[model samples]
Target chain A: MDLPRLEAILSRYEGESWDLIPVLQDIQDAYSYLPKDELQVVSERLNVPMTQIYSVATFFKMFSLLPKGKHQIKVCLGTTCHLRGGGRVVESLSHRLGVEVGYTTKDMQFSLETVGCLGSCAQAPVMMVDDKYFGRSTVDKVPKILKLYK
Target chain B: MVWKISDETAYDTLGEEVHLTINGVTIRAPQDQSLLVTARQNGFEIPTLCYHRDLPSEGHCRLCVVEIGEHPRTQIVNSCTYPTQAGLVVQTHSETVLQARRMVLELLLARTPKAKLIQEMAAAHGVYESRFKTDDPEELCILCGLCVRTCREVVGVSAISMKGRTPDKQVATPFMEKSSACIGCGSCAFVCPNNVIPYTEKEGIRTIWGRDFELQPCNVCGNYIAPKYQLEHWAKITGDPVENFFVCKDCR
Candidate 1:
């Protein structure tokens, strides 16, 4: 991340701390994760502390302070979803992925996470593979879904 | 045809423009238009909540996040507030964006278990359960701000504004009391996507020009289970008016 670009982005959100979220979001959008060097630059340029930056980065579920795999798998665990077997889907993914939630596979092929809900409960037990929605998922479908991703 | 022009001078003022690409589709828009609006206008579908055209964009719902460009990489940007800029690229359906949107929907579903839209959207997203604690508390308002925005912007009555902050924010009349400014037009209820408002009426009472009847709860369950009109409406829609189906809370 360029220091000048970071400063220019930060300049647009002068005097507003809440803008920090969006700014960080923009940074993450550019890098896939908040690069440590950029975080330092943002800390110095925005007059925000590095620890504060890290805290804010980790505070929201959206921000990723570390590198991620090429593919990100998000399983929906909303209530109607949960009742409809969202948990089983996540468990199956976790077992198959062999990495706990928030961790990338050693091969860097995938990262798994459980998400709140996607507001499509009628299609409960949903998992998002890359950009597509795989609804009404069952534990049995995990292998097929993972195979498609690979 | 002699049409007298008004004395007011009309001049076109062009503001700064930004260019961005969504899912490989190039677009140009005024810098102020939210990415969501721009994308939708250009035929890119991005799902959103707490985002009604009538309401001020309150990015609390976090459902419209999208991935943008290749640089200081942030995977998800709230499309509702993100400004487009020259040379910027956006992916409305990126892997990251889809995941984030699903997570947001899941969280909302955990809080509002009975909202039909939430259910439908969750189902569409393939959510079956909230991994978090299930607060299956029955609620209708997904807190999308459409009602509040419609009341203020369309109705010209700022009777209700979102109260509180994240994790506790909600649309409510001031102090959570009956609003004096509320014309009782039921626009809030009418426009609400979640159907969270509970309309109270006594037997033989009339409300908003419609006949009112006591909504009976299930005799066994005691859930304010059935609205009389809802039952009648369902019967009309389904053409099955079996009175026995209208069980009380206890029977249900």
Candidate 2:
């Protein structure tokens, strides 16, 4: 969060704009999300405008501007998964998490998101909590699944 | 395998070590190795599409997903790019992982109804048919990144890349036009198990390439018969104005 640390990081990538990816990655790695202060530091050190930094961060889904919860729930809304009730799964999760998609809980417990696909079609209606899969899920199982995290 | 002196010198300069646990199994990997590589090396099968050892891991295909222990709720991540940390707990095939994978396959199947690999994979998962309105059956490619990787690594030509993002993402020649660097190498076709893009040489007209060719079935037994585009392209390339060549071997 300090300007000096960010300046040190940016100095490592001197004369290389392409290194911006790794620099941003390092920042995200240190802090789960890109803080505004860090973004400002990166902008100042890299000589890139704050708007441009924000644009690049927002362009890729991987870079999150806000702090993500310790647990991130990504529901696959791909065509196959959607047909098999991907929407229902997200709805159930949103209702249970008390937050809409792309929002983290106040306690920093969970973040709900809808991803395009996770590439496993055998189990439709899939929801990934943290990094594990819960397949063939229904609204009924949402409570039990959420309880496991607690 | 003879080791060169230079190779030995390079190996001696190695630094740093990391230990990670995948599915409760502890393994030591070099600092540079990704979690996916470690898991695969240990015989844990993580499904992947955009990942190839020879090419840079694009991490577009979310197939090789794993749940890292640091995250409390299951988060589907592209394991191909996620680095392995010391004390990392990875769950490769949990129920959450399986469900997410199934949905991805289903969506791909619906997008490209004619893709044999998608259909076959779906069937293997007990998915008889997609519930969504099927896309035009002419499509074949699953946009799995094989063609893109082949072009970049083996072909040494970055002619094709992932054009769109997420559900809309697909491998295409630059600007979605026929690439001059293609060299008609057919490497993309060869690596594509789905037979999505077929190369055809017509007799006179410009050769039609990279489009999904219809494989007509045998009239007698109804078995998938011949590559319609191949015959058409052959006729056009050879300057033979022939229509009867469309029939399959049995029918002919």
Candidate 3:
């Protein structure tokens, strides 16, 4: 949404070919998502290809094409989490959020994603909102956690 | 190089020649030339999908594998990227080579079950139906990446890319939407072996990547010249005036 901010971010990078990832990260940090227009400008400014930019943007799990929510909710679907009913937690979250796993809410409150592992197997069926983890999370406990984020 | 100039060969200009055998036929060729080109020059038919003479070789298709070395120590290598070495023994049609090619074809057949090129190739190899699973029966892209390579290496732009990973992977523009970066040269369409890239020319306008690019017409005969967008890009690249591209071959 802020076009001038993109120039500032672009100016920060050394314009080296390898700086593409960091440049994208900084842009995503400034804007909630990688705006298509900004990405096109980045391609032109850096003299890279849209195909390459898009490839990098989509390849990484951190980048989102659409505007991500203020809070990112990552549900762990690792083996331990799955056995402990990670699927049910995902279903509950999806039902509560009214959006699919890889989408943002209409209100831009939260965007949901399922990660393979969060490295907190001891806290199985874990869901993380930004950096805060909710361990041993159940369907009933999901609404309370959602309320805390809201 | 160019070995023959006028009436004689230039030995001094030639690279070092290396001796190799293909199916027991001894042959001498320039060292480090791709084994695929060397084999083809010696009249061997090695089936490949991703090789283009003008484009850089990237052995993406894995369809050109040939068995190297003798029995008990044989190895399969993609002949397109495999350079010719001295004393190198290659089997372009050994039973192992056929089996490797057959497996490659079978996997390609399963991936793009509807691609006619793969269908014909499969039939030639006596593979009627794939034993593997066909996730999308209508899928035609075998991910050979010829179009992707041609666009970057030749056209000199990334208007499209091989996006995603595995079954979800595809060649697409940014965000899979109409890209403004595309010059509509149709180079991607031209290089696509599967011929699945949909584009059409009507009147004098060329439509590709969901955008219309105006084609310049020659002044003399009124035939369609290259796309004005493409000509501009080429003008910038080659440093010739944009007007120079307006002249058709016949007029030139």
Candidate 4:
């Protein structure tokens, strides 16, 4: 949001167009989400088009356009996890939080989402609340997990 | 135009050929030709779905994979993008190659069982049924990305894109909203392998991917001209007036 800070981020990339993805990742990391104005600045600095940058940003699941909440919730719906009641975990979290996947709560307390896999198939039906992994998660455990984050 | 053959040796040096074997048959082809092209030229019929001679190969379909060598072990690679080199031993229809191709076709069939192209390919490969469940019966777009590549590389306008991670990946606009950048060129529809992208023209109205454009009618006859957005795109690029394109090509 600040011009000086934006300029500092832009200067980190040495005007190399191939560094566009990493530049976007760094910008998202600094601001928690990609801002439109910063993306415009990136387009101009890298001599790339806005549509091209937007394509890459929207293509990857890692990037987010909207400001994320303080705590992130990722439910694994992988083949193993889904067969082990991972869908129920997502539905339970959605019902508890009153916000669907990819949306943050109105109070900015939590953001709910789903991922392909976390590579922890041993811990089937896993849900990650921020950095902590909740293995063998259930609908009854949703409230307890939220309480720990808050 | 008639003055040619100045030197026979000069002509021979200008054009060099690469020799390769496909399915135990020897063939001579021009240097740098893709394996698919060389195979096709020599009468070896390899099934392919996502490859087009005009566009760059993305190799997403994995149907044109062929066994590359016999030393140590053979490796399967997409023949559409693989270049031809001298003395390369390639088998277009080995048992391992057939098994891999059948598996790819089965996966494609599971995703888009209703697609006639997929059904035909599946039947040809003897993959009569898919072990995987079909998420959507009417689903199309095998995620081959031919349409996306043609739009970006040929049309030069990336109105649509492929998004999300694997197993949940889909081709759509950013956020799946109507893209303001789409010019309704129908190049995506033209290049689609399974006719996935919905396109229809009725009563001088054209709709593609849920965006409607009023078709420009020819001034000479009643037949419809190109979509207004397509002509507008051409006008914007060439600095021509929209009125100039009202006349149909037949009249022009």
Candidate 5:
């Protein structure tokens, strides 16, 4: 919906066809999701077909076409994390949020997803919100940590 | 344009010839032309499921695999993607090649158990049953990608796409919707090797990918020329008047 902001992002990429991921990433960052019309605009500007753009957007887990929440919570489910009650932590978080994994909250405040690994096994049962990683995560600490975001 | 690939490129002999031995028989063909072309030119038939001369060679099916180099250092390669070169020793019907092709056919047979062509091909390869699991017993698509390549490369519309990875991959319109970009050309259905893509034509309407298109009739002969949408697309591409395409090419 922010036309000027979309134009600014397009200018940053110089509309190169091969920079599709970074362009989509920047657009996702700017709008929380790749808008359909904006993607059409990208298709026209870069001379790349819409199907290809859609394929690339859907192929990468990082890019989302649907509207995502303002805050994204990632639970690391690596071997160490899983052994250290990561499953319980995610279940409790999914319960409290009343949102399924890979879905945004109805209020659009939080989205929950699980990652294969956060590469922070020392911080087993790790849950991350935005850029901040919460180590030694527990079911009891979910609500408290979520409260800090909004 | 239908069945035109056989005339255009069944055997490519235009470029400088390169000699290669297949099964101890010397075969000559244009340098850098695929080994499949050279082999077929020399009366050696290599079984293929995903090859169409008009489309880009993807080597997707691996049905035309053959053993290359010599014994003890031979490597199995898809002849559809491997180019012929001088003195390159190849074996089109070696034991290793037969085994590899049979295994590929067996896997394909399991994947598309209902496809009659696959059944016939498997029967020819001496594989009556498959050892692998069949996820969908009625699945006819072998994921050879001929339809996908035709849609993207030749049509230039890219209305359909090959989405997802193994076991989940499928050729589908964007978001599985009736795509606005399809142009109703029917190229996808035309290029499908296993004849899997659902397409129907009746009366004056042609249907595919969940959309209907009116087939244009030649003004002079009353013979159907093409889909109205396809003629419109051709007009758009050639920058000519839409009425110019209403007549069939022969009538014109």
Candidate 6:
């Protein structure tokens, strides 16, 4: 978030096009979303176009431009999950958080999103809070999951 | 290097040519060109939706798939982006090819059921309709990325780009805000196969992506012509005075 901290991240890499993704990843690690001003600095320093950077950033699901909450909650909406009541899971999460997918709660505690697939079809109706995966999730279990997170 | 004696006329060009077979018919094709273009030129009737000769290939549609090489080693690839090489054997209408093409068409039909082009293609492939349920029945854009490629590669402007991922992906301006970078060329609309992009010109103003730009009136014919930014872009590119383009192309 600070200029000196951002510069320290920038100092580790040689200014090159190949370093763009890693640099952006580090920036996201330091600050939850990619900053416009820092992206411009990467563009100037790495001799890449800002548009190209923005294109790469938006193309991948791993990157986010908007600020994120402290805890990231991802609900799977793949074919397997969807057929197994994934939509209900999303509805439950939305009702609990008072925020839709791709939105962070007012308290900045949780950000919710839906992913196409989690490569874990065996665990249908799955949701991930931070790094832990919870399978066969139901509306009744939403409050208990948040309790453990807070 | 050996060619059929009867079809020597096909390889009359001076450049080094590669001999390849499509649908059991041997043909001479120039190296490094896309297989889809060369195959179509050779009368193979390969179908494509996202491919425009002027734009770079993104191969998002998966409609132009063709089987390459002899079985048990054949591979299916999107012919629009696949490069032609010497001694390459391709089958445009093999069973595997048809099945792959049919699946692509059916999936596309599921995404945009009302698209007339997709419907016709489905009928041609004997796919009446998709078995899968569509998330959006009115969806027209198949996310082939032709408009995005044309805007960035040909127009030299990154005003629009693809956002999100499959099934939920869409073409949008940066931040979904009014773009400061768009030149209002309408090339994106021109290249879109489905005509999904809603761009219109009326009353000396061009409307694209929910934004309007003033169109310059021709000095001689009094017709509202190109967008102001387009003329300025041309001037910047060719080092010509902006005044030189005051008259429209037809008037000049």
Number of the top DockQ candidate? 3
Q: Rate the local accuracy (lDDT) of all candidates.
A: 0.71, 0.70, 0.87, 0.83, 0.86, 0.85
- Candidate 3, residues B23-61: lDDT per residue as tens digits? 999999887778888898889989989887766678988
User: Worst 10-residue stretch by lDDT in candidate 5 chain B?
Assistant: B1-10
lDDT of 2 by residue, B1-252 (tens): 122232112434433567888887888765555678778878998877666665567776576788877456556677888766777778998878887778877777777887777778777656656667665567777777787667656655445566535555556664445654454556677777677665664432223245433564555666554455445545655688646555567767
Candidate 6's TM-score: 0.81
Off by over 4 Å in 5: A76-90, A120-127, A133-150, B1-19, B249-252
lDDT of 5 by residue, B1-252 (tens): 222343236445346777879889886778878888788878899999988877768898998998999889999999989888889999999998999989999999899999999999999999999999999999999988887778877887789877655777787877777888988888888777678888888998989899999999999999988899899888988899999998898887
**Deviation in angstroms for A94 in model 1?**
44
Tens-digit lDDT track of model 6 for B1-252: 112221223345324678989888889888867788789888888888887776667798888899999989999998988888988999998999899889989999999999999999899999997888898888999888888877777777778887766655788886666677798999989888789999988888899988899999999998887899999998988799999999988988
Candidate 4 deviant stretches above 4 angstroms: A1-7, A36-55, A73-103, A112-149, B1-16, B239-243
**What is the DockQ ranking, best to worst?**
3, 5, 6, 4, 2, 1
Give residue B148's error in model 1 in angstroms: 1.6
Model 3 misses residue A136 by how many Å? 4.0
Candidate 3: residue A67 lDDT (0-100): 92
Candidate 6: which stretches are off by over 4 Å?
A: A1-7, A36-55, A73-102, A112-150, B1-15
lDDT of 3 by residue, A31-150 (tens): 879998898788878877888988888888888888999999999999999999999999999999999999999999999999999999999989999999999999999999999978
Candidate that beats the other on DockQ, 5 or 6, i.e. the better one: 5
Which candidate gets the maximum TM-score versus the true structure? 5
Worst 10 residues of 5 chain A by lDDT: A54-63
Off by over 4 Å in 3: A1-4, A120-123, B1-35, B38-44, B66-77, B82-97
> For each prediction, how big is the interface RMSD?
13.8, 9.9, 1.1, 2.8, 1.4, 2.3
Model 2 Cα shift for residue B37 (angstroms): 1.5
Whichever of 2 and 6 has more DockQ, that candidate is: 6
On the 0 to 100 scale, the lDDT of residue B238 in model 3 is: 77
lDDT of 5 by residue, A34-118 (tens): 8898988888888777878877877777888789999999999999999999999999989998999999999999989999899
